[model samples]
Target: MPTALVTGAAGFIGYHVCEQLISNGYDVVGLDAMTDYYEVSLKEARHARLESEKFTFIKGYVEERDLLMGLFETHKFDLVIHLAAQAGVRYSIDNPRSYLESNIGGTFELLEAARAYPPRHMLLASTSSAYGANTVMPYVENVRADHQMSFYAATKKATEAMAHSYAHLYDLPITMFRFFTVYGPWGRPDMALFKFTKAILEGGSIDVYNNGDMSRDFTYIGDLVSALIRLIDVLPERGSAPAGETDSLSPVAPFRVLNIGNSSPTLLMDFISAIELATERKATCNMMPMQAGDVPATWADATLLTQLVGEIPHTKVPEGVAKFVNWYRDYYKC
Candidate 1:
């Protein structure tokens, strides 16, 4: 079986990706720090569901170069999925050091390890927040992204540049995934969906930032995992971008960037309505001004992704929200 090393294996996306990888017959080794960014119990529960003979779990920090180097020397991973990052946009405002340590230092350590034992492909997670300050609609991969609004996003962007340099110098095959707002079952409690659902179900008011004026291209976890799996073999060659297409493939390095999103932005109020419908309750919304390190909206242009991997998922907001609510009710027994 092909061996894959998945960092952040206990995280929301990491857990789903590991489960999918194991189901696909890959011998997966999952490494996670299990940081108390949110609820540790949720992370542990996700990892618990991933127990399998084909899966090996490691609880540790991604920034530990010695630990990562040891794993690289031992397993010779075919794929390295780096998703272990300090991940909250607002949280980064007060905890900038954590972002630097996890998102920046952790990625540097991973790249250093990969230089020694190169994987077939290294998929590192980026965020739509990295598309900072750009008011362009339908974020295209070829569009120049700079002026990040959040420290968390800035760290992720930093990793993108760091990985690119490593790719150029070491010829390391890497694909940076600019993920839109990913949400579904086993989602992070810090996310809006989870917070809002919890508050609404508890008969409490939900904080509606920017007076609920924002929108997001909320991609479901299942869809995002599927997109990732499909792109695992879509290796980037220096000059092998599809003909007559706007590709983010680097001209000098075997590296590329792709946006994995639903491509359909839903209004904040509409998302709230979806949750209300799912929970069969009206939300008492507390309107508030936009917080630091937040954007009013985000939409992704998945044309390049479609050209590479056939059809992308288009799960509507109401449908996806319902699924999450169902899982939340079942998991929380609320």
Candidate 2:
């Protein structure tokens, strides 16, 4: 069976990606460190569930050069989906070294392995936060993203550059996707939807950043995974987007950065209200100023993504929020 390597397999989106690949008849391999950055139990749960006949998992850091190199040598992967990173904007402010090790160093190691044994296509995960400090509504992919507000965004952006260089030098077919605020069932604990659900369930106050005035292009996890699957098959050639119509794709390398987001940007209060309705409870809100290194809003111009993938993320906010709340309740036995 053709093999696909998915790093951060136990992660929220990684787990979903792995499941989709396996269902589509690809032999899937997952690598995760099981870091305590959020909750180890949650990560373990995801890994345990993915333990099946066709899925093989390795528990280790991607920065481990020998392990990665060995894996690449042993299994010439048809596709490598790199999703592991030091996530969380606030966390990067406290400990930037984690970003350096996981984001920069890990990416460097992965690229080196790919250099030796090139995959048919390599999909690297980036973030919308990479479009930092830009007043541009509905952020586009072709624009210069040099001014990242957070170190987390900086590292993700840096990896995009690094991957582009590798593609240019080795002629590796690569697709870099900049994800918007992805949220849904089995979501990350650090994310707003999850936190708000937990707090509301416990009858506690939830912190609303930017004085509840912020908005985000909240991409549902299922929609994001679908786009990724479609994109894996739509590899770009050097100096072109997939169909030679979009500019977001790179001109120098077989690499392009596509935004995977629901083009609708919902207000913060509305997002909180979705969770409240889903949980059947009202949140005691604590509206506050924008935290450092955080953007007030994020909206994705997914025109290029739609053009390349021939689809757009169309999940409704209320429905997605309800799915997450149901999962949360069942998972925690609340």
TM-score of each: 0.99, 0.98
Give per-residue CA lDDT, model 1, range 1-334, as digits (tens).
8999999999999999999999999999999999998999999999999998999999999997689999999999999999999998999999899999999999988999999999999999999898999998999888889899999999999999999999999999899999999999999999999999999999999999999999999999989999999999988876565433678899899999899999999999999999999999999999999999899999999988888889967888889899999999999999
Among these predicted structures, which one has the highest TM-score? 1
**How does candidate 1 fare on TM-score?**
0.99
Highest lDDT scorer: 1
**Model 2 misplaced stretches (Cα beyond 4 Å):** 240-246
RMSD of each: 0.8, 1.1
User: What lDDT would candidate 1 get against the real structure?
Assistant: 0.93
Error of 1 at 264 (Å): 0.5
Question: lDDT per model, in order?
Answer: 0.93, 0.91
TM-score of 2: 0.98
In candidate 1, which residue ranges exceed 4 Å CA deviation? 242-244
Candidate 2, which ten residues in sequence have the lowest lDDT sum? Answer: 240-249
lDDT of 2 by residue, 1-334 (tens): 8899999999999999999999999999899999999999999898888889889999999998688899999999999999999999999999999999999999999999999999999999999999999988888888878899999999999999999999999999989989999998889999999998999999899998888989999999999999999988888898653454545666778888888889999999999999888888989999889999999889988888777778755899999999999999999999
Question: Cα miss at 275, model 2 (Å)?
Answer: 0.8
